[model samples]
Target: MGLSYEELMDKQQWLADELTKSIKAEFNKQNIVIANGIGRNRDGALDFSLSISDLDNPDQSPDVELIDFAKAKMKELVPDSDANVVGVPTPKQF
Candidate 1:
């Protein structure tokens, strides 16, 4: 049998939460925070379009340096996985 809607939602949330934590934890900075994610891709890996909050300056747009740092860190974390880090945030998924 297939999973219920609630079950699926829970699973999705759980995955998202774990992904967020893992990503955030790898980033050893205090100014970044997780905003939201568009859920994982249907592909073979745990891909998601993520957003992050810039604690130092949340109102302004994302800095290019910050985004690059995020992408690099992500690559380091999941180098072999097919999980692509879609969006690095204008500032908001920790």
Candidate 2:
């Protein structure tokens, strides 16, 4: 019993929503703003950015938690797909 295309899409959307919630929660708890942008580059590679306002303060930094959340969500959404978390630079050190 394989999942239908629509079912797969729905599952993907659910996973995305779950990830977004986790991201928002972390940002709120850390009193930081996260700017998220998703798109495909000229080379056809999917690019997503998660920008945090502060980076130096451990309590306000979201990098490690974001990476962990992404990794867990990726595994849940696509068990066989290869997904890796890429860290991005923040605007300033807290």
Candidate 3:
């Protein structure tokens, strides 16, 4: 049988908590800023972005390795979750 509403909610909360902890640990280990955001345009299109940077030195932004690390952690926490990144270009030199 499929999960009940309550079961689904509990799973979601658990996933959130797990993801939060994983993210925090990564941030502390790498001393990076994980910038995340979500929004919808007037045309009803959804948009989101996730990026990382060295908190100790804003000029030292994160690279693909860091982004991939975060994405992997997120996927580990929520096996079925999907994340997409659009046109926002990654800094060429981080």
Worst 10 residues of 2 by lDDT: 41-50
lDDT of each: 0.49, 0.50, 0.48
- Quote the lDDT for 61 in model 1: 45
lDDT of 2 by residue, 1-94 (tens): 3344454445544555556666567555433344444444334444333344334443444567666766676567556433334445554445
Full candidate order by TM-score, most accurate first: 1, 3, 2
- Could you say which candidate leads in lDDT? 2
* All candidates: TM-score: 0.45, 0.39, 0.44
lDDT score for residue 22 of model 3: 65
- Candidate 3 residue-wise lDDT, 4-90, digit = tens: 344444565454445446656865644443445543323434433344555555455455655666667766654444544221333
RMSD of 1: 7.1
Candidate RMSDs in Å, in order, are 7.1, 7.0, 7.7
Candidate 3 lDDT for residue 29:
48
